[model samples]
Target: MDAVRNPYTPGTGRKPSALVGRDEVLETWRVALERAERGKTDQPLVLYGLRGVGKTVLLTQLRHDAEKRDWWVVQVEAGADVGLRDLLGEGLYEPLSEIARQGLGRRALRALKTALSFKASYDAGGTWTFGVDLSGASGGGADSGVLRTDLKRIVKDVSLGAREEGVGLAILVDEAQDLSSDELTTLSMVAQAAAQDDWPVLFAVAGLPSLPQTLSEAKSYTERFHYSHIERLSHTDARAAFARPAQEEGAGWSDQALDYVVAESGRYPYFIQQFGQSSWDAAEGPVIEIADARVGVARGQNHLDSGFFRARWDRTTASEKRYLRAMCPGGDTGIGTGEVASRLGKNLNALGPTRAGLIHKGLAYAPDHGIIAFTVPGMESFIGRQPE
Candidate 1:
């Protein structure tokens, strides 16, 4: 089989040939966007899931869908190094500048310009020069270095300008769990202003399962945000997502073959694509048999360990890796921090920073008090291989 003809995409953040089991969420956001634009009701949407659950893919797809309706969409991400202010400055630069030049709300525009400037550098013509007509629209926006106090006015202004254009602003933030409390507050204030003024702006954030807890520490009003907890696909949806892409490429899957792929992949989208791709490549003819799926699953193990699992493992510190590997023996759900401490021969109290560090790295998360699990499934097996 030609590599170019492979229908399954196992690459990071790549959209699959078939997206299944998420129709409800897609439709839900659609209705919410429509209503928000009409000033009926609005709430920020947060999609929480473990790694490889396709939250990034969903966000990308949603942005595409919204853009088809002529909506203004901005995709930003908070990462290991990037802060929320810089991410906002980068993602919102164009939209803020575009809406400002139209002059819908003059004062708000000035305030937004100032706030963004604080996020950027003074040498860059006073923070984030939005080129074109905004070359001189730099000063008098938000006071320098005061992001929280000035955020509401800037957002109110931007959303108003967006409403005037008849298309709203959609901010998609990935890895939002990395955001600080103050950063989350800045976003909350924007959402509050939008609801009060009927401005058309909504945030769609995607991050780990711990994100809701992380956001709650900032404001109890997070209940105002629509929460979507992404889980594994159902048996039917997982099978369809497993088969449809290869079927479209003219490869047929036997009933047993499809079942094996689905079961072995545990309904995780990333693993399904990995196993499916390997199964397709392993088959001699157009139809994939059970033997091919078995071999594919075997071959796919190395692919997954070397690729997906390895990425997360490589990001861990030596001490963090020890903590995660110790976690493996406990089972898939999670391991007690006490057990982890015993394995590491360290005091539980001393291990607190290490546990927190792993969570920050996105390698693992705390599901409950004194318990933690890897953010990605099957990490136990991955840790066993080649002795990390």
Candidate 2:
């Protein structure tokens, strides 16, 4: 078998040949999109999980599925530096343009543009003003300011326009935990306004475990999101994930070999693909042997180390690295706050900012009330072999 025909994709946001154990989530989204198009209301979605769990991949797949159903979509990955307004503006450009041409009035169209390219200014009372011209007299409310009011207006226009075009509007956001408080509030307002008008607007956001809390803290109403947990695959699905691609390529996998790959990869989708590719490359004939899988496992470990964990490790500062090194003993799951603080010889309160920083950087997360863990799987192992 030629290597060029490998059916596995293990890179960033790449959809693998067999997207195993994800049919339930995908089907849920399919129904939501169909219902939205039919003017039915549903709570927006919030997808949360650890790193390398296929959230980004699922977001892309959902967007593709929506496009197939004649829905209009705007998608973007949120970041620390990327403000929500600008992020939305960048992703929404083509969709908004299409909607504007579909028949938005001059005023609504202008409002959308100003909100897209906002310039901040502070009034005498130190309140920031965005110059958003809402048609009504505004004293002061959550929906008053520029980003809030105008973002709502933008959604109203886009969703209504999409309805006129006989399609639904889906806002797919990845790395959504990085969104600022203001940005999150505005996004919630947009969804609320669309719901009120019976406009078909759907929001699907993917991020770490804390995403729902972040969104809700930004706006209490945001707690209503329908959360979908995308974690590792089951043993049965894991074996099929590796076997399906090899089978499709006219290659047969031994049960022992498949078992080795599944056990070594421990149900992580990316690792499963890497192991499959390595085993396929190492195979001498049509059948993948246990020896071939061992070689693939070794190679897969190196690949995950040098590529996945190393890249994230290289991005942190010295203090952040130390903070992570302490959490490594916790392994894939995570370490308790008091334990990590004791390991760092600091108070738990003192390490709050540093801990929060790691979460903000997407390097780690606090899965429980007082426990911290790296976002990537087996991150502790990567940290254990480090110099400091």
Q: Which candidate comes out best when scored by TM-score? A: 1
lDDT of each: 0.78, 0.77
Candidate 1 lDDT: 0.78
| TM-scores for all predictions | 0.90, 0.87
Clashing pairs in 2: none
Per-residue lDDT over 328-349 for candidate 2, one digit per residue giving the tens place of the 0 to 100 score: 5774687898998898899989
Which one wins on lDDT? 1
> Stretches of candidate 1 above 4 Å error?
94-140
Report model 1's TM-score to 2 decimal places.
Answer: 0.90
Worst lDDT window (10 residues) for model 1?
Answer: 131-140
lDDT of 2: 0.77
